[model samples]
Target: MPRTEPRVRRLAAGLPAVAAAAVYGWAHWCLAGPASPPTAVAWLGAVLLLVGACVAYGVLVGGSGSVFGGLLLALALLLTVTAADQTASRPATASCVVREVHTRLQGSLGEGAPSQKTVYRLTLDCPGGYPGELKDDRAVAAVGEEVKVAYDPRRRASPAPEAETSPWRAALCAVLLLAASTVIAGRRPGPATRPRPGFTPG
Candidate 1:
């Protein structure tokens, strides 16, 4: 066997998946052009697709923490698509006041800070608006602070905060997540994963 580094091969494999994600994002824009309803199916599909990618990556990695990166990658992908989808379809914008903030562990983090960040629930006050749950990294948004929220015109109850995401950030994270997925896909299956003889995966 030509000892090919799994990392490299995984990355190579991830390129297409990343591109697919991009295509889906763009298609979302096209389909939703000129105003379109937020399809629950689309949201569910996006969630499943991203989650599937992460699971695939996790399986590829195969280790004690079998699905480490996969879960985060899944979330990152889901949120990215959701955010892009909203932005593409003329997401309804409204201002809201932060009701409260709570910390949640995500994944890796930068230097001198927690790996997780705080999530803020805001009370949206706008025509045809309802309270919503939103989150942003610690770098932005303080508890009890007023901020602008973007959400589906049809369902104002589910809001995505502007501070939670931006174009550049989304693009950057997409690429990073793809790369991480690849890296994770390259690991060997740990002792934790082993099918005994005549035993099924289940």
Candidate 2:
């Protein structure tokens, strides 16, 4: 019995890692496919599955460090899946008229007087029922000008002239979070000590 206990514990500890990997693989397969854009229902289902896996791992591991690490792992998986989805899917295009244009200065107003970049927000009206606003650093269109905007009808998010989706930044963050989770989950709890015979409560 004593020899079997250690093996059981080792197997339990490995379960979460396996589960996390499985969830990541499933998400990539579902979201990063070259088929039609995934529906809102598909997205919701994937998110729920990912959350359930993380929660199950946390509960099974039964440690503060493990729980926290599971959370970090969940976040990393979410980012990675989202980046993959955005990178793989193709967006629909529509011609929109720029209704209004607003500009704002972004960056630090510091002691050294660093240069601030201008951010442009454009309100657009599209014939394809795409009524949304877009914000970007470049001034791509002027008021009353017609410009082409790319959008995902499934997401119904604000359309933009260009889809600036890249997986590198999100992938980088995911890698860092995954590393932290591995380090934390691998940590063993400190040894417990009993009070000495002469020790008394303070």
Candidate 3:
């Protein structure tokens, strides 16, 4: 009976992570489908429900482990939103003429080191005024040059040439995060031991 108890506890602790991953996978699949994605209200409702669930679980569970679980759930929410954004848009190509070209040096400090890189922003004029602008690290087009731009027809937003999303990356990340969250939750610290009364130092 004692042995079975630990197994049950572990499963219960890990269930939330598994559920989160499944939810994210479903969202990604829906976003990638031909049908329209969920409306903003639906997304907001889901977010609210998830947040409420986490809060309720933490309050009811009443353990340090719940803290970690809540954090993981929050992270899952953010990842789901990002995956939706990446998959909701259908890729389309348009030919445009560069109306203006601007260049700037973007710098960042990382790992105690500073680095600088050039970024090129191009204003484009397409037949339908689609993908009116683009930015990239490489100067792929010049002013007055004709170029093919990839964009989302629905949003009319142009993502950088190298910023394309991979279909499997989000799934892989969700799976990995789920595994880590499960392990952390399942292996949560056990109750601390107190020394027996009248026990002297050895």
Candidate 4:
């Protein structure tokens, strides 16, 4: 309740927040520009924010009548859960044939250049594997026929064939954040271990 207490608590609570900010912010700058630092920092923000909230909750609003505090805590927790879900979910992959592949005209960014884009509509029925080179199919599929397709469940819109990219660094960030929050929230000072009044020095 004292001004000094609040100030001291703020200082203590600020260390990790400041560290997370610095690390993740640099990560952002590197990922978007350098292209080798890592692409996981974007997800790291949620973890950092959650850990910070847990620390803040313990310090700024540990006593009664802390409705706003609880709300902030819940919001941060939810953000972390969602981030974990996003990071943990695996991409589903299936193969679809090029029943139809063509270059269609497209426009974007308030410009009219008539861009050429490749679009593929798979013919069904082939199932399992896709045509390796289009000329290896035993029975070529017609417009109304079937074809094989490969796609990701998480990224259904984006097709990745033979794509190799790791998201471990990102998920590790979430796990670390979760662990930090748990530790801070559950931490408690141990009982004093000094000699009692009834005890004598050896």
Candidate 5:
């Protein structure tokens, strides 16, 4: 019975890791192929799902309910799948001309509290003969500045020229997160310990 208990515990602990791998594969599959940005409702749904995942994990890990572990795992899987699908969509590229530039002050003005930052907001004339605006924290450009903007019109209403540089970075970030989580999942959590009475030890 004692040996069986340890084996069961290890098996239970490993299930989450297995699920995580499945999630990684599912995300890759969804994102690797042709994709498009999901609707606003879909985005909202994914956020809600992740929130549910947090709740479900809490219920499971806190020993309030055995069923929630499965729920949490499933929710996480679904969330990642949705994210991958949304991220895989192709972006529309257009040459944009900055029509106006506006600056805003940000951050604290107190001494030694970092300098006040300038945020640049630009109104632009984009492709398809529409007016749009983009904001940048570091870019300093005058009115009538010409720049190329890459944007997913469906996902974002306004396209930032600077943002159109890389879509592969998102995939790369997901891969890195998966790798880090895998490393973390492989380790067995340490057993709980009761602290010894301290002798004023720092």
Candidate 6:
């Protein structure tokens, strides 16, 4: 088959996934109020889920039409959607003081592997009478510093801070996934490749 044919097939396979991402992105903008930072667990779960799905799909796509790929693809897309939703919505805003700062080092052991990176968390006194803590890749402000927080007032007892996410980043991820899915589809075994057990050339 021509190289372009495989690529086109792959892109077609990924169209549904891309459309889903777009819908979630739109819903996020409509529902989420303002942007704040998401919790550590939320961010970690989403990233890990996406990365895991990509790796799993990469391994299983060779099977061609395996349900595993579709399942993982769905999970990854769901994470992407949830991330968008969390990023877009914050019903209320308040000024809070950074009561404390905490940091932790994270990485795995290997030669020339990824180096350890520090994760920062900030404890804040959220407005509307609730205290909250938020996590981020880097500290947005220093301890004892006053900062603005965006939250959903409905959860007055334990309001979660809004995490800022770039729409472009989500778009880029969708594009990359579409490309990867296309490549995998192109690599799938064609109909002619089936073996006949008793066939032989005499």
Each prediction's total of clashing residue pairs, residues at least 3 apart in sequence or on different chains, is 1, 0, 0, 17, 0, 11
The worst-scoring run of ten residues by lDDT in candidate 6 lies at 154-163
Q: Judging by TM-score against the true structure, name the best candidate.
A: 2
Write model 5 residue lDDT over 11-97, tens digit each, in one string.
Answer: 445555555555545444434434524555444554555555444333323332223343444534553554454454446777788
Task: Estimate, for each residue in 1-202, the C-alpha lDDT of model 3 and write its tens digit.
Answer: 3344465556546666655655555555545545645567446655765676577445433367667655665555555555665655646777788899999997753322225879899998988887778887678789998887766766522354433544366555655655555565556532322234797547
What is the TM-score of each predicted model, taking all chains together? 0.54, 0.57, 0.53, 0.25, 0.45, 0.53
Pairs of residues at least 3 apart in sequence or in different chains that clash in candidate 2: none
Candidate 3: the clashing residue pairs are: none
TM-score of 3: 0.53
Q: What is the C-alpha RMSD of each candidate to the true structure, in Å?
A: 7.3, 8.0, 7.3, 16.8, 9.7, 7.8
lDDT of 6: 0.54
lDDT of each: 0.53, 0.63, 0.60, 0.39, 0.50, 0.54
Question: Where does model 3 exceed 4 Å of error?
Answer: 1-11, 33-38, 56-61, 84-89, 95-127, 130-149, 155-163, 167-169, 189-202
Query: After superposition on all CA atoms, how large is the RMSD of candidate 4?
Result: 16.8
Q: How many backbone clashes does candidate 1 have?
A: 1
Looking at model 5, the pairs that clash are none
Q: Tens digits of per-residue lDDT for model 4 on 1-202? A: 2334545444434434453444444443433333433335544654566555555555543443123333334443443343333333234544444444333333322222113443333333235443322221123344544343334342212222323223454445544544453344333211122235797756
Give the Å error, residue 119, model 3. Answer: 14
Winning model by lDDT: 2
The sequence of per-residue lDDT tens digits that candidate 1 reaches over residues 1-202 is 1234444445535643674466466446544545543666555655566656655555555564335556546545654664565455335676776665666656544432225654433343444445455645442446566777766565522456664434566656655665555555544442334445697544
Off by over 4 Å in 5: 1-38, 56-92, 100-121, 127-131, 135-142, 152-165, 185-202
Worst 10 residues of 2 by lDDT: 186-195
Position 128, candidate 1: lDDT = 49
Better of 2 and 5 by lDDT: 2
